[model samples]
Target: MSRAQEHPAPDPAELGLTSDCGSCFGLCCVALPFAASSDFAVDKEAGRPCRNLQDDFRCGIHADLRQRGFSGCTVFDCFGAGQKVSQVTFGGQDWRRAPGTAREMFEAFPVMRQLHELLWYLAEALALPDARPVHAGLRGALDATERLTRGTAQELAALDMPAHRGEVNALLLRTSELVRAEVPGKKKDRRGADLFGARLKGAALRGANLRGACLIAADLQGADLRSADLIGADLRDADLRGADLTGSIFLTQSQLNAAKGDAATRLPAALSRPAHW
Candidate 1:
């Protein structure tokens, strides 16, 4: 089977609260640049491996990252971006083996990282029952994003990422506005509501609590889900083309498999699409 076929892409549904890191190659520890802060306690440059990264590409302090002053590592989620770049885009070759490919690989890493971030948000947008009015648009956006993720290295390299990001940002802003506009009072609980197949075009859902909600087949085009809590939500076949999910919480693999997200849809850490798709 082709690589893509070998990795059954995850659906953004059936999120039973589990993190899936099977698709990753520990790229975040090596490919990303970090500065010492509350999140991370050291300084590292892009393309340089983290001091805590083990030979097998796992974290040497995996069990005690936070205590070891790598708290940021614990919170940082690549949304499967590392795996896609390491295994799919580079055809399973690492920077060490293909030393010449390092520059390109490093360059592509951040681009894919941003796209995966968007997928996470789109997944969360589809789970909100209140944003049921724009489901169709959301699905369309999801498909578009998926295609972008599968583009060739040259395509990704040449991409005007800022322009593309701007387009997605517009949609996420709208999603946030729509979702939060309806609450009569500031203190409303819309957690775990069933919003399968709802239309939520251009909705804004920032900082919303949607834990354990059912959002299968929902439309979430151009939705904003920044900082939303989406633990254990179902998102099977939901649309999320132009959604933004940056800083969203607790998203998992089971949720992604149930939903229909594309390259443009941002995703959280720990999950990735099947390379074949």
Candidate 2:
């Protein structure tokens, strides 16, 4: 039996890594900046609320985000950072009501997002039975990252993000190696390859190390992507119809959202099928 079968998959909701927009204070709408591109219809600066952000902190164009030329908003996932900052970091304070806290809250949102992203990856790593050798270290990193997320706004602002991310990245890389090692025979090492718009339909990419690969608009229709390490890979507009990603590691909802997939595409258990597919 494969190492992944050694243990049952953990509940992704238990990790608190999924976005809950209702609990958020529209932090992503205000904290993040977007330029006028194919993704965004208008340019929005940081710390400024999007025009579509309603008074109740919900997106006015949520249902029609893609049709309204705000497809960028549809693909963006804060990994539950919005609710964490709104409810925990600021203690349920709404930036609209507590205008004084707006600046700091905006600053803390992105920082918390990064930390929470690390927590998400670390949690997934712990679920991998093949990565059992580093499970203890992964737990420590997860705990540390969660603690960082709970820090004060000032603490988050003063954080050295590069250093912290680097430390966590090292552990994640080790976990990836341990888990991906289970794949027999030769494995593809296409880490960071720029395959933008490459026509690779029906590719035999099982157990491929595609970390950080630029696969923007690549034709991956019906590809076998099981057991691949897709952490940080740019999958924007990549066709994934009928592709199998059953055991892919480090693939996030944001990546899936950015890609093109149909019902026939097999995703990991934790991820959902993107509505845009």
Candidate 3:
């Protein structure tokens, strides 16, 4: 990891981790590939623009994506990588205006997305009072990752993403341990478990480690998930109705957007309730 000078930690709110499509150049619509799954209506190869994308780089069915068989688009979050690439990395020169750079730009989008995602997690870790012991490490990782986001397209496309992600994941895991330890009793260790269609409604999963768990379509209604580590958990179609996720760590908006929830589902202060829920 790159060493950064000691400074105040980056505020998660100020990092622009949320997607701003208006400032973007339809990168997600063009750079990403989607299959004819329940999430997408049709297949689209990488570097190909979605049919719904407009000349002005706006989604033609943005407000009605879920109703239009493009439910996957609603859950996809670039973590502000789109605008960062369009405006900063590429200096606001869009792919249409500079076709020569389009391929490199497309390749760099995913890489930048990963870096931004790590920044989001690190920033969240820094805010946890129980994770104070590892705040220094978290801040350093956040700084390093943010710097990586500003690299040229060539540098980003050639980055060793897995190695960097592993390093940041270690720090996040340590932070999770510190925070979850505050919860009494033996916490569940369900990391990377395959819990597809699980009937875990009302399960007591407080302080549980659920990192990278495949929870697709699981019946998780009314589950108590306070203080649980949910980094990288696939929650697509998972039932979150009446679930209390009040202090859940690493739960992103995109994850919630993918799940089935209701007005009764409690969330952390950092996340908002999805409209479709």
- Best prediction by TM-score: 3
C-alpha TM-score for every candidate: 0.61, 0.94, 0.96
Clashing pairs in 3: none
lDDT of 2 by residue, 1-277 (tens): 8545664444557667788999999999999999999899999999999999999998998889899999999889898999989999999989888899999999999999899888888888888878888877777888788788889999999999999999999989998888778988788999999999998899989899999999999999999999999999999999999999999999999999999999999999988898779
Q: Please report the TM-score between candidate 2 and the true structure.
A: 0.94
Ranking by lDDT: 3, 2, 1
1-277, model 1: which lDDT tens digit per residue?
9433553333543321123455556677877899997558899998898888876777778888767777556545566777788777899887777788888888887888777766666655655545456544555566677678788777889988888767765665566556656544453245779887888766777667676678777887778776566765676556767677765655655455545556777765545652212
Query: Comparing candidate 2 with candidate 3, which one achieves the higher lDDT?
Result: 3
- Backbone clash pairs for candidate 2 read none
Which candidate ranks first by lDDT, i.e. highest? 3
| Candidate 3 lDDT | 0.93
Error of 3 at 140 (Å): 0.9
Rank order (by TM-score, best first) = 3, 2, 1
User: Each candidate's lDDT (Cα)?
Assistant: 0.67, 0.90, 0.93
